[model samples]
Target: MDLFFTIVAAFTIFWFTWTYLKSKGKPPSPPGPRGLPLVGSLPFLRPDLHSYFAELASTYGPVVKLQLGSKLGILVTSPSAARQVLKDQDTVFANRDVPMTAKVLTGGRDIAWNPYGPEWRMLRKVCVIKMLSNATLDKAYALRRREVRETVGYLYNKAGSPVNVGEQMFLTILNVVTNMLWGGTVEGEARASLGAEFRQVISETTELLGMPNISDFFPALAPLDLQGAVKRMKKPMDKLNAIIESIIEQRLKKEKESGSSSAVEFKDFVQFLLQLKDEEDSKTPLTMDHIKALLLDMVVGGTDTSSNSIEFTMAEIINKPELENPLVAIPTPRLMDPTLYK
Candidate 1:
């Protein structure tokens, strides 16, 4: 019975799209590679989506239009088109397309994936004022400096040995973020468990989020479980949610014991959220789910991006050995032009 229903829905969607496209007067969007009917260009998408899009742009001019399943996607490769999207029509394109994996992993509460509306606005404001504002970031700078110093010490201890720079960089960034969010460092056995959990959550989330799942574009056939990708993602999402819930419960218990008026100095993200929860905001009550989602953003956005950039910088330096020579011969800042000093 479910199969029959899925087939009927798929056919209905196809027929509706056919009629809609026929009624449109605009020339069928810019030309690009042809794809299978119903599924469209999804099959062609690669793990490295940026490179795939770049290749298509080279073949079909700067702007290439393609249909991913039933959804229309326009890839702009030209600098002018990028500027237009970023500056001229920024608000129009501000909202993101959240994939199924992201929705499940974040429990549909992350600000990055939230649709543009009141909730998004409220969350964005909270993030700016409580989390990423200059003052909050400045307060965390000492934590960052301490983490970097420890990392340098570790490298010094491993001198003359071939170091796994990737592992070291990941630990350095993770320690910094953990300190900034939890008001303490994860060390000994706790550090190992935290590192393992963090890496598993981050790695799985990125892989699932980036994968081309047909159900996202062809929503009518979602229940069919055609690709089985949705089923595959369930375990990791559950694990991530469990980790987040445990952290939240621990923080809440600690807050309760400390009492509401206690003047405990907090230099972490979780403490900041707990403080916000105490405020009288009837309009936007900070629910458990909201706290979990914010933590997800802090872990995913805060740690992964910075660590990746650090890896990239290391890789670039390795590729050009000359760049490393200046570190030994002269101070790092002296390499920069004095005229461009900010």
Candidate 2:
């Protein structure tokens, strides 16, 4: 028995060494900083990832390779390298690196995370051509106008007080989007309440989305959720799901009561989506899960982009006051109207 065990150990060592030596014939990989054994460069990562990447690019040239735990990350800094990946060979790089928390939040049904295929093509068509087309935007202009007016009124009311521009913009945009989505089905106070709830959940959801999850890097350890990012995301996901489910249920009930052909009023995005779903197009069937996922995508995606842009602009303006030296447009009392920036 001892002799057999020794032989097995010796054979394993020999096989490993042989495999390592054989791999040495291959071309060398991209240059990158050496990292630790298991965690790789994770422990050394900074909160400001962009700056860190820029620093690394200075050392490793245009393309820097990184081993993030069990995952491999290639950082392309040069414009040519970026174009190569994003434009020249877009099809090859079309798929996204979906985060574990996002999968749970979207239930693996959203366009942002769904693999590029027939389903993705369908979602893109529905979202771009059907729902958010120029004609659709024109139809929803009233909602946008109303929300902007309300925001102006809010700012006017809070005149002379220190107002949080970002927070206000986020709320206004959220209101406009929600109204465009299913505002017709959900009215006044309920709509406002729902917006508030959505704001909280969206904030939580986006923050979780940005967090680095260990499970994402190490797939084998996904079930463990060592970072607790997935666990933290569940509360927001559940709350958002409940809100959406309730709205969908109400919409369905209304449809049943009013009859299918009742053209009572203006249809929102939700109504249009449900109408498409009922058609049951075999090519790309739109399920309730898809609707919910898309809605989540809109709420989270829309608010984050707009609000963050506004906040960053505001920060730049305030932090670098010299930029407003007559050359740059300065914010003043007369410029109270947010529309002026537009």
Candidate 3:
């Protein structure tokens, strides 16, 4: 046991020292708060990471560099710097820096989180053409309009009752996303159950992504997995994957029973993925894991982002009461209210 401990200790020290020196050797990047020896600026990380980046950008010009443990991050706040990174050097910056939890939750296959490569290219192409292309998006606009109208009606009905508009908005967005992807809108008891499950998965995922993960910086410490973030993520990830699999299985069964080519017309994103899975053109046939990862990405990317933006806008409106009454009373059609539409 003593010999084993000594060997492990020596290896850990050597690995950390090597990583520190290698990172130090890189050409001088943008500057920000000087971090500690090993953990870097992890201690300063906040729930709203963007704000922290903004603060640093204000101090260190619009292009600020940050180190979180061993992970290096470049924050481009200025339009010029953003253009340089996103437009000019897009290929270099396109690759995602996948942390351990993302690898497990996404099965390392989610297009949004996947490294820039051929597989990502294929998935991106499919998403753009099949799901978000102008024609398909137009087809889905009616679904959005219906959901928005229903949500507005619900809010209008509760006008006198003190309601949590944020929660209502989140549910509204969640229902719209569910309907768009699954061909069904969650409601009442079912919505409560599904919303709980979805929230658990998304919360766990965001926590894992946003937390200052030490193992990601010092690979030697990965075995310890000190935070147990990885273990905690596994159960939620499994539950989410099972939910997606069940949905996919049900769709396939329905398609088989119908035995009609017309069923293709009713297909959603999952059906598009299933077709790609079987296509001979794919160099790597989409596996169950891949499909699940794609679904996870769609759920996370589609739902949380839209909901958060709505929440932010609503919060701003609530904070500024002077703009509220007029905005709410605008003569525009209920569904087309500029105050809420954008």
Candidate 4:
């Protein structure tokens, strides 16, 4: 046991020394905490990263270098530095260091975490230019109306009842998103059940994305996934993938039954995407994996961000209202002055 302990200590010291000497020739990093070797600043990470990063910035200048295990985290705190990366020279820094859970969730095919290059450019063009064009988005107004009407009707039905606004808003957002993707929308109990699963999955997935994983920091140990982050992530991701597959299969079956395009016309985002997929002559061909990943992206991003923002806004309004208008209340239906969403 004494010999084993000595061997371990010697190996650790040797490895740390070797690593330090190897990096000595590289350009000097920005001023920041000189954390312990091997693990670096991982031990100093806080739950509230924004505040922690702010504190670090105050001490180590706007650009702080954090050696997080085997990875290096460069903090750009200043608006000008951020602008240089985000807008001025955006393309140069378009790629991201994807986390394990995020990679598992999107199979690294999503536009959010994909490396900047030809494939990413293609995804950008497909997702942004074509899908979100004025003509395509204008078609979704009816979808928006139908969804909002359903939500209003639901609120009307649930009068004098205690409501979980966050969950309800998330469900409505998910339904709207799914409806915009494909015309088949569930309601009532089905929506409730499905929305619960989505809430759990999205919540878990996002949390895992934010969590610092041992595998991510130590690439050599990624396959092992020492912290079980990767294993935990696969569960929700598999469920999400299954949901996407079911939707795709349903659409394909419907298309086959209805003769693919028997004068019905392609209406929804799914139809448009599938039509694009069938186009074999495109230089950067869109695959089934790409379609699935993009759909998952839409579901996760749309539901999570929109619902969270709305919920926060609602909470703030409730806390300090400009007017006494509660967001989740049943509307008074007067035909005279319709303030939209009628």
Candidate 5:
């Protein structure tokens, strides 16, 4: 037992020393707050990530390198630095370092996490040209108008009463997206149930995505799920996956019953994807899994971003009387308005 302990201690020291020496020889990494051993800067991470990054940028240069456990986090603060990475050297920086939770959600198949290659290019083309082209957006304008009208009517009914602006906007955007995807197929009781379920899961998902997971920083420790972040994230993701699967099954059933003659009547994104899947294509043949993953991206991305923007804009208008009457009002820069003041 004494010999075994000595051997373990020696091995540990040797590994640390070797790693330290190897890193020492490399070109100097960007400056940031010093981190503790093994866990790195995780313990020092603040709840306000944006503010923390800002502080780091102020202390360091525009580009700050943070030691996040076994992973390296590069923070780009300046617009020029960001442009360089995103445009000047796009191909080199195209690949993403996907987290454990994201991998579980997408199976590393979705365009967001997929590596820079033919598959990603194909997926990008499908999304840009076929799904979200100008023609498709023009056709879907009516659906968006209908959902917006419904929301306006609801707000009008509750005129004086207090309303949860964010919640309402989220639901409105969610329905608009659903209608565009499948012509608002899930309706009445099922729609209510689905909306509630989706809201809960999406909230959980976004929270989990932002969290600092140990598994994300350390790949070898992912299977162990030390912080249980991956496990927690998977629950909501699985529920979402099941919902997508059920929708796909119902669509398939309808298609089978309706036959090929009704194929031309297909209107929604799901129908379009299904049709594409059936068509003989040698390059980047669409699969059902890919369809589901893309749908997940649409729901998660579309709802949160649009709803949040609307909510923020509404809040700004309500809180600031200067912008209350925008058409005739002069733009006075508020201390809070970073863009205008800066």
Candidate 6:
């Protein structure tokens, strides 16, 4: 019965898609696979998507058009084609078909998924001119150094125990990022627990973001959420948002108690953004939602990318000491006959 229902649904969907495409009269798309109307190429997709895509590129041209269920996928294989899409005519491809999970997390307000427009331009300006300026980063140098010292000390203390390099690096990087964003929002004993909880949430969030959601490939079925990607994402996303909200409230409370006129030192991005929110005289003023979204971007995007890079590099260095550079090596004696940063 279940199989019968699925088959009926697939046929219905194919008929609908066929009618829609026929009505549109779009130009001849790139040459590629002629998959079955019922399932398309979804069944043929291998677990290693990158290699599978490469295999397809070998058969088709650099630009391959794939019928992925209800969605049309255009795969760019060659560097020149990539350059044209990403650089030459970037505006044409600036907007992304955001997954259901990402929409839940950032509401398409964050820089990563926001479409290229005035608002996105304003966001870019805020991030670049405020958070990523040389002066801003220069101020953060002390925080990074301090976190490094603390991590090394902890490693020194736990000399005999088995240490997971990736996990430790994640915590270190996350702490540094959170401090830069909120300036000691979670303090003392709770900080350790927060790190563990945050890491677990982040790991789950990344997994959801990467997972192939039916909503992504079949927009008509998105509202149904047959896979529950959006549902699974909300808990962690909400927790992270709650944490950000608490930090914002605390900062706002401090402003109210101290009085806004009083000289409050801008030690972190939260304070800076709050101040900017009031003072911004632009046509599209920065709202609290945008501020929160950007914070989510940094926490989710920055820590994960940096930590994973460090983790992979450390693993390679530990495996073959010859690749160890003084800057990013693991320490000696602990993983003896191994190289770490000097």
Using TM-score as the measure, which candidate wins?
A: 4
On the 0 to 100 scale, the lDDT of residue 2 in model 1 is 100
Top-lDDT structure, candidate number: 6
Give the deviation of candidate 1 from the true structure as CA RMSD: 6.2
The segments of candidate 4 whose C-alpha lies over 4 angstroms from its true place after superposition are 1-16, 156-160, 319-342
lDDT of each: 0.76, 0.82, 0.77, 0.83, 0.81, 0.84
lDDT of 4: 0.83
Clashes of 3: 0
Q: Write the per-residue lDDT of candidate 5 for residues 34-143, one digit (tens) a residue.
A: 77667778888888889998998999889998888888889999999999999999999999888888878888789888899888887788789767889888888887
Q: In terms of TM-score, which candidate is stronger, 3 or 4?
A: 4
TM-score of each: 0.82, 0.85, 0.83, 0.87, 0.85, 0.86
User: Model 1, poorest ten-residue lDDT window?
Assistant: 333-342
Residue 27 in candidate 5 has what lDDT?
Answer: 93
Better of 1 and 4 by lDDT: 4
Candidate 4 structure quality by residue, lDDT tens digits, 1-342: 999999999988998789779889899879999888788899999988999999999998989999899898899999999999799999887877888888788879888888998888888888786567888677777877777776766666677997778888898888778887877677878889989988999988888887878888888899998989988989988888888898888888888998864346656777777878887557888988888888888888899888889889878887877534554354755422334434
lDDT of 3 by residue, 247-314 (tens): 98987887788784255666777777776676647775667677787778778877767777887888
Candidate 3: which stretches are off by over 4 Å?
A: 1-28, 31-33, 44-62, 260-263, 333-342
Q: Please, what are the lDDT tens digits per residue for candidate 6 over residues 1-342?
A: 999999999988988787677858677779889886656888888899999899889999899988888787899999999999999999999988888999999998889999999999999998898788999889889888777766776686678998877677888898888888887735467767777788888889899999999888888889999999999999999899998899899989988998882386565788888887998888888999999999999998987778889888778878986676664565645533223223
Put down candidate 2 lDDT per residue, 129-235, tens digits, no spaces: 76688987898788787777776776777889998787777878887777778865234677557666666788889999988788988999999989899889999
lDDT comparing candidate 6 with the true structure: 0.84
Candidate 5 lDDT (Cα, whole model)? 0.81
Q: Model 4, residue 286: displacement in angstroms?
A: 0.7
Ten residues in sequence with the least summed lDDT for candidate 4: 333-342
lDDT for residue 131 in candidate 3, whole number 0-100: 75
Better of 2 and 4 by TM-score: 4
